[model samples]
Target chain A: MDFGDSPEESEFRLRLRGWLQGNNPGLPTSSTDDDYWKGAAAWHRSLFGAGFFGMSWPTAIGGQGLPSVYDVIVDEELAASGAPPRPSLGYLVQGILEHGNEDIQARFLPGIISGRERWCQGFSEPDAGSDLASLRTRADRQGDDYVITGHKVWTSYSDDAEWCLVLARTDQEVAKHRGISAFVVPMHQPGIEQRPLRMINGMTKEFGEVAFNEARVPAVNMIGGPGEGWRLAMTIVSHEREPGELGYVARYTKVVNELTRRVRVNPSGFREDQVRDLGWAIVEVEMLRLHVRRRLSDRLNGISHGPEGSVDKLLMTWTEQSLGHAALSIGGIAHGGGDDTALNTYLYSRAQSVMGGTSQIQRNLVAGRILGLPSS
Target chain B: MDVRLSTEQQALRESVARVVDQLAPHAVGEIGNAERTSKLDAAVASSGWRELRLGDDQGDPLATGVEAGIIAEEFGRGLADVSFLGPTMAAELRRLAGAAQSESAETVAFTSDLSSIAIAADGQLSSFVAIDASGCSRALLLAARSDGNFLAEVDVASDEVGLDLTRPSSTLGSPASLEPSGRSISDDDLMRWTALGLSLTCADLVGIMQGAVQLSTDYASQRRQYGAPIGSFQAMQHMLADAFVMMEGSRSVTLHAAWAVDALHPRDAVGAASVAKAYCARAARDVCETAIQVHGGIGNTWECLAHVYLRRALLSSDIFGGAGNSLDRVLQHYGIGA
Candidate 1:
């Protein structure tokens, strides 16, 4: 029941804190800007250069072979020091490490870990979002390459990524989930095109619509055997849902801390309900922090989780929305004051329930898988 | 950091769950069943859970707050018709004040608003309510002074079968005689004790949510509608899933609060407990209400166990103050608001 860090964890945290003191890349003005993401990539490279990035991955790759808690500490210190977020490549790394063959691993993981290559996931199409297994993407086998043709929406970082981990149908006669395969398709091929989408938060480069017109990938680039795409996709989504592994707790904490500072700087300006909202926001963020730590504790104790990742996703959604509302209310609802970060924060939070998996879908997974409820 | 329970703590939880299963009231009518109540009381007495916070040789508690919280949570889950929260809180105060432990059964008295512990003055206790007062002869209070607060005790005036039927509370009918325990309590001691109280209530709220969700989930699986179990409906499933998520979040936060009570500084422990209380207090009500909604018409009736959970949740929510008060505590700690 001890919640204090171990000697090793504490030491790592302290050292990371000291490192961040000098190496901090101050937070960008707007996440929607191209410069923000460009700075983000540079920050990722800097952290990697400092031996602070990817510490949880195996040493066989580019990581330091430390416990996952070190990643959490790096995230916590980065946020606490107002640094740009660590590059969210954990899910991509996990997908490749779990499903990629030794050849694929040896070729891609080092570049990904070292931030030499950027990657985006190509799973959700316009027609296959919640029902991702029904994706229309196709990869036809050729002599030495599989030419892919698909449309991927909400493909984050696609505009800048050099590689896209894509899911495409390899067989037409089998079940929807069984017909699919995963590939590490190069993003800059002649047949590939990326158009950045403007989010409600006015973020364009953050999410893009990528179109694959006979994009060629070598046969060796396939992540897993045919019909293994579903498993790989599931691994990626589940890993993505873990706030602890993804360092999302620190991200939310950063937002809540800013809101608290605003309210403290001018305490009487806010209404009671708005103040209450801020307090609730603080509570939700703390809940996420403790929840992630508890999940980490479970991992430390060798407890493997499956659909329970849905629980983490739902909690993260609630916390993000709560923090967003707190920001909006405290920042004032009326617009046009030369400051739209609060509105942007709220707008971005709306994606929490929509992206990764819709809240409804996540709930259905929790019910059917974790609670053993009957499917209708 | 590790939040997993130790082997002994796990064993303690299992034992408490067994006791609750064996003797806890299973229905509303069984709440006052003398046979079951007395047996439950006897089991609780022998279990020494209420004495968990009693001072050891060095005036530290016999068991940490996490152990006490585990017992509290299990009891809350089964709606065990006995006293644990009140007696344990009294023992905690005694330990903090370095006073000798009471021999007979005792409980703690809270203010009329149920926000803070009651303060006795001039050998008379004012408008106060003693919660978890079942089978208790006296309630403990504090005597305020310039130097520090001291421990005091008063007779339980009368029992009031309040909104929560499982556990009875007592209100002072007259000024109960206050007797000084002769040990002073420091501000740090009180803050730490408050942290423990907040944590136990949060743990109880977690248990109540768990019990409510389990009851609703079971019913949803069995109750048929439109030629299928109601649980098969997406609406009902989502409701139950949301409730389950809230319950797990509460459990995670509460575990940290319970651990922080003994591990951190007094003020920091209270801060952590306040965070847990705010989260658990808000989530418990929602989860309990969702449980009622899941059961449809039966949930509205008194016989259904869903309302019992809601009632218990209401009491635990208000014990250290509800969501609003907890938020204020947190805000105050941060010096963020007037």
Candidate 2:
């Protein structure tokens, strides 16, 4: 079987890599253990201006739509170039256009594409973390606008957002999944509050809580149908976890490079086992790379993200978490004074198994859907 | 980039799922029946799946009516009892090592090893041990050594004193069947095939585990304990969720490895395959245990049939080498010390 890039894909990579050479943001290579988000937003604007972002959206709405491989290629370049992920708004808004209506597209897609507007997902109330469908938030419809009032904790980027695509209960009488509708609620309205949740990284630029009290949004801001938020959220998350093998390959390369540097320096005085551990991590990452690349090929070929996506997430979660943990163990849980790249990695990866639908949820999907296991 | 299997591959997958869902899963409950393994042989002959090996013309052994891996993966999903590895390895021998000079046999044992092939060296092969020959597959042979891989079927008839029943281990005074490496395949090629077979088997176990998890989850949800569906409890949710994630994560790696064999091939397949198998092996264990845990008391009883899946998972996991071996091989391929 041919796993290497096709000649065409090879040519695509050359062109893509060439473009990224000058346009790359060139952050620290060890950002996994460093706060490389120093100029994350400006990096976003630069990448966006280079026409590197939105490579897959229809050109009419600001995308080349050139084989979707271009998007994978670009993201690969972005990661390899050490460019931090753009704002949550950048990721989610374009995501909306892919699944949202034309009206919603025209209103918000351009602003997001140009880096003019930002967004935060208004999901996750205190009561509904993993069981997000059980969230208690409501958006009552008014004449020209809908008044939204709810308490959302751990909204990743609400404070820095111009608007939020809020998932609120529009049909409270219906069971958890049914009655929910998503709306684009403006953040400038009178009744919106955002509070930063202190983090170990202390990067207050992103991640906070959004408490909406009579926040007003245009009635036309409703996306999809009244009960389609579940579908939209699922779609967004699936896409989030399953795209870009090139990106993972790029990351693997970068990590391996870092690992090699560490081994060469030998300052930490690691033994054979530690070296083996480092090597194991590198191999695991490579293994993960192969797995994700296969998925990327499938997705680019117009294959829907199905049980295969679960495989991607599973490998990714373990690889990532393992890398962090390994880094911690080899590099020391808390290195000299205050550095804990590995520790932070370990801590953060704790969420890997838990977030974006926990490991259990993915397994349930695998067992029930992919394997055709009988569910009670 | 996409991770989805192609139409042909998808169809293969469906057929596999159908076979596993309909035939294999049912047959798994009756573990003692030797007839279960041969059932697919008839189907394979009629449907020309066996001919998929020789193909319509046998000119391009790689070019079967379908993708080569489709058959392997389908067998994996079905939990077939046949020795898939022996034939796959033997077929490689026939295709690469010339047909008439060397006779390639499908999964037969105790036929003829090192002592016999070593003395009868005619640039042809006799028998090769399917399992790790790192032991003593060739300790007694010393007359000549082939430059590359050889296909030989080892007969452990004289040495089957304490081999496990589940695994069919045997010892041999002489080689039952053998092909010397006049032009044998590379270690990488064998690894790719082994990885293909193992990854798909893991995929099959994954299927079984998937079924088990569902059965357990369903049972938990429907069966009540302490005035609530057991599934309603947070502890149960966490346990089931762990199994869910394990299965899914295992699947991603497994498919990745499978695709790697085809896509990356010569360079990356070995490492990828090991990782996939390691992940799948471990995941199968987790899935089996969690299914039992989720199933609770009923799951433990043979009458409940939960053990059917657990047994298969355990059996398949150790067949091509267990998790540790797979992991070590993966590390070795990557030049990482295990």
* lDDT winner: 1
* Decoy 2 TM-score against native: 0.78
Residue runs of model 1 more than 4 Å from their true location after superposition: A29-33, A303-305, B173-177
TM-score of 1: 0.98
How does model 1 do on interface RMSD, in angstroms? 0.9
| True contacts recovered per prediction | 0.87, 0.26
What is candidate 1's TM-score for chain A?
Answer: 0.96
Per-residue lDDT of model 2, residues B95-176, tens digit only: 5444432232343222132101223354232343332121123222212345654544343342422121222334444544
Candidate 1 chain A weakest ten by summed lDDT:
A26-35
lDDT of 2 by residue, A232-259 (tens): 7766666555525214445545555455
The residue pairs that clash in candidate 1, if any, are: none
Best by DockQ, which number? Answer: 1
